[model samples]
Target chain A: MNHSVRAVDRIAPRRQGNWDWRAAGNFVAGGAGGGVLACVAALSIGLGFDPRLLLAVGLAMMGFGLTCVWFEIGRPWRAMNVFRHVGSSWMTREAYVALFAMGTGLLAIGLGTRPLVAATGLLGLLFIYAQARILAANKGIPAWRHGRCLPVVLSTGLAEGAGLVACAGAWAAWWRYPAMLLVPLCAWRVIAWRRYLAALAADGAPVGTLTAFRRINSLFVWGGNLVPVVLAGVAVLADAPILAVLAGMLTVAAGWQMKYSLVCRAAFTQGFALPKQPVRGNSRTGPGVKPGWQWNRWLTD
Target chain B: MKRYAMVIDLRRCVGCQTCTAACKSANATPTGVQWRRVLDLESGEFPDVRRSFVPVACMHCANPPCEEVCPTTATKKRADGLVTIDYDICIGCANCIMACPYDARSIIHQPQYAYGDQPIASEAARMDSQHIGVATKCTFCKDRIDLAERTGQIPGRDPEVTPACVNSCISGAMHFGDILDSDSNVSRLLAENESFRMHEELGTAPAVHYILDRR
Candidate 1:
């Protein structure tokens, strides 16, 4: 009998169907869309921008996101069942919270009441938290299950929301407030993203995942975080509202890139792990190898 | 009150894949979908290489992650400790597929004949399998087990009622019985051997056990 031993990574197979780009789209649109609405409502109560226009844009973006996910399920007709398991499932909670958010958001826009707007904004934040929890609960994917995922997803939504409001702020000449918020928020995103990557590398995540993160990292840092920070700062220095507007747009793009790389490129399933190796003849038993990660020192390091 | 379980003796298994074939025949699973499979693991350096065959299927854990993550109450754990998927209610969102760390579940997309484009009737192509887009996995031959229980016959001991893979094991490496029962074959095997479950650290508490070869 031929006893040829193949490489470990080539032998073991990875799992399938955790989530795809479509799901990522759902998170991005849902979180950022709700965030924009919430921020706009906040600005309306403070700066007196048109709540109707901001509320409309926010609702449209959120609906678009939900529709994208509606097409992704295997059984679309029974999609309402997502609300059935609220006790244990985060996805169910997200569905219920989303409904609550829309109801309050509409009331806040109609009545222009501070209490209504506060309730809407609070529920909007909860909605984003629920989205983060949905990914965190997936223990099968190492990258998604990481503790940092909660913060990363949450911050991305915040940045995206602030960015949208900043863009609108330029037109309304209220750009200073959101542009100021964008600098610190974008700075936080940059730092948090770096820490997240370091943690993944230290934990020995798959080389493919790390590489994807590195590729997407540059875009988010330079364009999403750093560029926006620069633009917002320049706007403050030069007293130019256009620079602040550009910063907001860049922040939104960065948030999109973050979710895309996470859900599509870096999202690998946690495959099989065998505790003990099988014995042959009188040879000593050895530990089973984990196959998904790359082992080359130079490439991994 | 009956908790069914399985034990595999690695020493007697020769990787013949008779059990794999038996399962496919009994269940009529669609193309590319395997309810039972034998994974061939080869390790060690040259001239002193080692080859081992591990038969892997659904663990049917005591605390099943699939049931916890399912948005619909489709994936359910029965009183007898068997995990079953209810197809009619399943939205096929693939949530349970991701939650199962064992990679035991498969989302069946389109029905295909064993023979390419033959338009033949595959018996496994009906019921849960018939649904074009739904999650499918091993049921531990629930129909046979149900029949045996109703007739007051013990499973595992009765070849006519045990899991198809366990009954087809040529080397008698596979054992199926109630681990909760003190007199059951699986309980006795567990007591007498050095055994381990796959991914035990995940706190899944799998019902399946493996006995390493005592060389």
Candidate 2:
């Protein structure tokens, strides 16, 4: 998995700066929270009923994610400034949307209003979109900046939310319909994830990143996507409600794993690049130096 | 309309790292933080190898990615083409640090001195606690340039008004001037010599140019 070459430490890497575990956790928790709310809202509006679990769990997850991000900031007192950049920064917009989603969702659940629940669900989707953009806007990280990142993130959130609904559906029969969507959702996620990795390799991004994803490919593909699909299939075929709940839990866990690796492990910065090499005497021009990703490999290899 | 730029002559540079030392002292940077750096690159096979020193800092691009991704609009590019971060408003999210392709911006997590916990008097005077936990980079000595402008002195020409790295370069490898001005030294060099910017294909339009060595 060590695809990069290391050299001397004269030049620094840009990837050192970014959203760490707290940020990754925030995406997972918030996406799951909003996704759950959206699913519940749809169920309530379409079926003239809502699951209480969706309302409570969704908001709780979103709140937990926000709290994690809050703790991650170096300056806690200046946290409120996250709202100042709504016009430009996706992070700001995500914050505002999260607030709106929470407020409207709470009101919808408190008042037992179907229309309000629908609006909250729509806002929740918007919140997920904002989170996707927040990562994509980081142009330095080639893996995160690819076009597939948005769809992959959004679909995983939807799938995780659906899985949650299916798991909760074990108690309530009405939750089974959303659970059925998990297989297709997982399929979409796997496709998108594969496409993104291929694109990264094709674009000649850091070899280390390629190797890292390759090493973890089986986990993401089989553990995250395939396993959930099989479990959900078995739950449906065997008519076992308990098995359905297990499938839902597995799907949710897989979604979290995908995001955790994407934000923390797969995330690498576009290090410094020299377009032309400095020449001396009559020697042929040498290859340009890339210090950020290759430094370690250059030293050892 | 005045686009200030720096042109470093690769032939004249001796890889002394005097510019790195001068920049550290001038900025009073933290222990791990360096606003300017000299990278020594060794190319070719053992017997035929050649060494080149590349002095790097913030390129002050015309289209700056750092400013584009700043959540709080804290990283701003002035009309003179210098990119600066407003520490008071910065939330220390480190977004700009990731956005910058140059590896220019740094987030100071905590206070650290050259020696240890207790800093000397001069170091203590320069240490701004407020700067901690915010994105910071080379300002190209904006304070000195501002003072020179107010005092009716040319920025690149005046020894006291220029960047510390440019002033400290003993081999005269680094030259600073307004590229847009036809009469400026950098403009003349840019027109005459074969020069190139780093990662020009990225469309950053870096203000720093390197004059390739013919000898």
Q: For all candidates listed, what's the TM-score of chain B alone?
A: 0.94, 0.95
lDDT, candidate 1, B1-215, per-residue tens: 89999899876678888988998888877777888888766665766666677787888889888888888888899888899988888888787776776778877656666677654554433534445677888899988889887888888998878999999999999999999999999999888877788768767788888887452
Candidate 1 residue B79 Cα shift, in angstroms, is 2.0
Q: Which window of ten consecutive residues has the lowest lDDT sum in model 2 chain A?
A: A292-301
Q: Give lDDT tens digits, candidate 1, residues A1-301.
A: 1223343322343524446767778888988987786677676778766677777677777777878788787788989888888888888888888888788878877886777777777777787888888878766667777788788888888889889989976867677888888888888878888777777776656656777787877778898899899999999889998999999999998898888888778877665545565554664555665555543332354
- The residue-level lDDT of candidate 2 at B77 comes to 88
Candidate 2 ranges with C-alpha deviation above 4 Å: A1-6, A10-18, A281-285, A291-301, B213-215
Docking quality band of candidate 1, CAPRI definitions: medium
lDDT of 2 by residue, B1-215 (tens): 67789999875778899998999999888778899988776654656455667888899998887777777877888998888888899988887776666777777777888787898788788988877988889999999878876897877799888999999999998999888899998988878776789867667889999977443
With candidate 1 superimposed using the best TM-score fit, by how many Å does residue A87's alpha carbon deviate from the native?
A: 0.7
Q: Worst 10-residue stretch by lDDT in candidate 1 chain B?
A: B121-130
Query: Cα deviation in Å at residue A148, candidate 1?
Result: 1.7
